[model samples]
Target: MPDLNIPVKILGIGRYLPERRVSNEELARLCGRSAHWIEERNGVRERRYKSFETNAFMGARAAENALADADVGLNDIDLILNASGTAQQSIPDNAVFIQRELGERAAGTAAMTLHATCLSFLAGFDLAASLLLARRYRTILLISSDIASVALNPEEAESFSLFGDGAAAVVLSLAEGESSGLHRAAFKTFSEGAELTTVRGGGTQFHPNAKMTRAEDNLFHMDGLAVLRLVRRHAQDFLEGLEPGLSAGLGAINLVIPHQASKVGLRSLERYNWPREKIVETLSFLGNCISASLPLTLYEAIKSGRLERGDRFLMVGTGAGLSMGGLILTY
Candidate 1:
């Protein structure tokens, strides 16, 4: 990567979790394992499961909250960007549905989708920054909504117990000055490990309605150990590649908000000597919410006052592409 130094800022952020809370005990019954086994395996005690909340509904709600937090209205948004791992449907993009769910005020707003699995938000943040810098869009609404529970494989206790459903949104705009913006953005995908985590169906390769598609084809699958191994192999070099001396410590970084991949995934940072106190985590309660995990964790950090304006923080994570991404920014 190169020095982006994009002058973009997160104007507001918000998250929306489903009303239903699924506890590990409940999941154990479905997976035929003990609650303790689920917890020990994934470090998730409880995760939200959607009842009737469609992806668009959840996303719109979160976007409304974000707009409120930013002190802006729907009509003020210049673009609507949907960065989600899962789509509400196959034909139309998810962003348009989110725009529709936002009601008439969002009519005619440019909408599209950009997905990088779990790194969707990070990638979107990078793109949004460039757009703002180029003066293409003044105020961008970025939303991530994932309904992981729908695709979970009950037979796979580990992955089944590791994911949850949620939505998160952020409003981005140009920073008034050079004070708050992105300092660095880097992403790399290891295509060799792409098959390690995926839902092999619902695409052109494995159409959901195709007679050849098996029930398992539509379910989420993961070779947890393999994914971890690949990440471990490249995480160090990748971090240092993002910014020199980053592997040793955060240096001037005030906080680190990582994707809530899992209990072990978040804890893996300790191996690089990153301080635990500096990392923000919401996995225990939220589980791995796909792309929403990163921004949702960021939302929690701001709400808790751990991350405040003028503070520099690093957002980094691994996603389904067997990809690792990092963005360093000042809040």
Candidate 2:
């Protein structure tokens, strides 16, 4: 097969977080649990909260910063794609709000939202690449933001200890000459395990009825054992499939930004022999922000100099649909 030649290059990256920082101690106190119990299980010592800003607001902030980093005005962008698991509302798509914030300068730009649970950001990346390759746009802005804490059961010790709010953005443009950014990506799903991780009542399955108000049914629920089994069985298969074009040695990968679902999930990938130093973790401090986690981690890693030009990075995201995706990028 011929190599798929995609011209997408990451022009800039940006991230934003809510002002409130919720520590494990505070969360434990709120949930009537011990801090040690939360830490030992989830490795989450702290997480951010979006008490002041909504998802769209946070996403706009990140998108603006990304545009600035790319040295482009809002008018330069031809498209905007917001990827989030949590939206401000069930309808009217958050991308519309973001377009409004960008002003008349973006009047000609196309705006939309893409949701595929935790893999949403990667899905956006793929879409943007395709659009740019087809000459549909010169530059596309991709933002991943989520206010996952709002979906959690404050009363559930597990959920209370492991969720955060944050947003991150990336700008992708056609490679002008010979730059490297997104090289290859693959996405897959295991629908049979879909019931293992999901909210039981909010959607069509159960709908929002009186029975849906039950604490457990209302909150995000997961069968940890089932998730573990699935991750263990599938993560390797997913990564191995994309390993060929990665080029860099496993140890040379500056970071492996896996979805910040749980400490257990992160550690399971480690057991697959991914280098510890190369693994960028936000679960301990930010918990899982769902679709926002990998991009937020990437933004931080770049800021802290953990990711550098010529450094290869791998992203793996898995979420409620029992979906999994892998993407390899060269910075």
Candidate 3:
């Protein structure tokens, strides 16, 4: 008998990029730096910034595309999982807002949000697999949406130019055949570097209503070098633990869809001797959309015909929790 506990299979994938494209030149003017400086550091030429899109609006748009790709409808989705690092509001979860944007047909669908900074999508995929295997849901809509551009700090040119706004969605269902499913997954968190990347306001600890809260406190911040150092120290071991040949090279993997963290982060893959051709990246155009980065990259790979059914690929990234996670899947 086929193993009934395998990871959920992806039925369809979709992405939504805002119409307003912010070029590096625009960011350079805002940061008082040259466009070349921004590109050289972040590998981003341009990134989308929402003119009128909300997190829910973008996610719903992506979800509609995914549903169409899957040949399904909003009512067909039993659960909606928003894996965004940022929410539309502080009260109800982001998934609820997505459902609302999806219209009345999705009114009674179950909704939840899973957040682990940039690894939010991976966390949702992991959880969805388990829930599907347990017969908890028939089909699930997983979304990762973030408006990183709005929260970016212009004072921090490196990080500010490395972020963008976008959303991606995937339709997942139980594997109908043994050929496609998640192979193995692993994650590790090192809180010692937790302060390396953070947004200090909006949460209870730094509530916006608090008199001491400053506008700067709500902006995004990152010590890229510090976070890279911590990830490098443990990446090799973590990869080997997830899958044997992964540590040595990408010989067994067809493609790698990684979070568009930064130019430095993508370059780090070179250390594993993984061929540049085998890695899928969207940083140059989309920039880092927080948790939306990975899934959006995956969508691009699929649309570009880089990943195909029965091909084995790896999805991995480091998030603000100072966490690293990997998922091996047969597409």
Candidate 4:
């Protein structure tokens, strides 16, 4: 049986990428490297930048696009869930801003956020699906948006060169129509990697006002090699934790939309027996959009005709919390 017994479907999907394109050369100049150096190391040729775009602004625009794509109206969304990797602000809740930007169409609705770093979007997907099954919400707009550029340390070329800014969102509803339904969802974590990938500053532990806060504390950092090694070490167990459902899910899904985390990490999925051609990747061009990575890649897959309705998919990735998550569903 699938993880989710109740049928749920994505009614629409949308993405908003900034017009300012940052090529490998531009990022290289910032880090004192060549374009080839960056690409050869991380498989990133270029990435998008918010420039003047706020995370909330990009999110709202993406939400609009998704609503339009789903043919869903503002009034149709009963819940607005911001499942972003980072909030635009520490207060006021970024979801409210997204709701306002969605115009009056989003009035009189509940808005909230569910955070798990890059895994937030996948968490939101299951959240919306569960709510639909419980009949608490008729429709949901789940969004994932992050601007890693601002928090990046240009001096940390390995990490800095691999980030981009963007947002991707989806409209989900109970499978009352003829569209495909959500079939399964699963998430696993090894908290030992909690500090492996993190933005050590801006939170309660590393606040700006803290006397001992170092400048680098506020910047995003990842022990890239360590993370890859950890994932590889736990690869079999992690995949096994996903169980019989996962085994079948691998065969059942038509495409795999993975988090655009790293070149080595992505290629490792093939070791699980997944077909190379069946994986959808956007890390080379889009960089890692944090929480937006999965959905952004999903948008790319759909736009490129790699995905179509009635298709089965497995969305999976690892994130800051040392988390591994994936979902099997029919699109």
Measured by TM-score, the strongest candidate is: 1
Q: Which stretches of candidate 3 lie above 4 Å from their native place?
A: 1-7
Q: Write the per-residue lDDT of candidate 1 for residues 139-193, one digit (tens) a residue.
A: 9999999999999998999999999999999999998765898989999999999
What are the clash counts of all predictions, listed in order?
Answer: 0, 0, 0, 0
Over the stretch 285-331, how does candidate 3's per-residue lDDT look in tens digits? 99999999999999999999999988988999999868999888888
For TM-score, candidate 1 versus 3, the one ahead is 1
lDDT per residue (tens digit) for residues 274-327 in model 4: 888999989998999999999999999998999998898888888886888877
What TM-score does candidate 3 get on C-alpha atoms? Answer: 0.97
The candidate with the higher lDDT, 2 or 3, is 3
Model 3 misses residue 172 by how many Å? 0.4
**Model 2, 9-83: lDDT tens per residue?**
788998888989988888887888888999998999889998879888899899989988889778788888998
* Comparing 2 and 3 on TM-score, the stronger one: 3
lDDT at 109 for candidate 3?
Answer: 97
What lDDT does model 3 reach?
Answer: 0.90
C-alpha TM-scores of all predictions: 0.98, 0.92, 0.97, 0.96
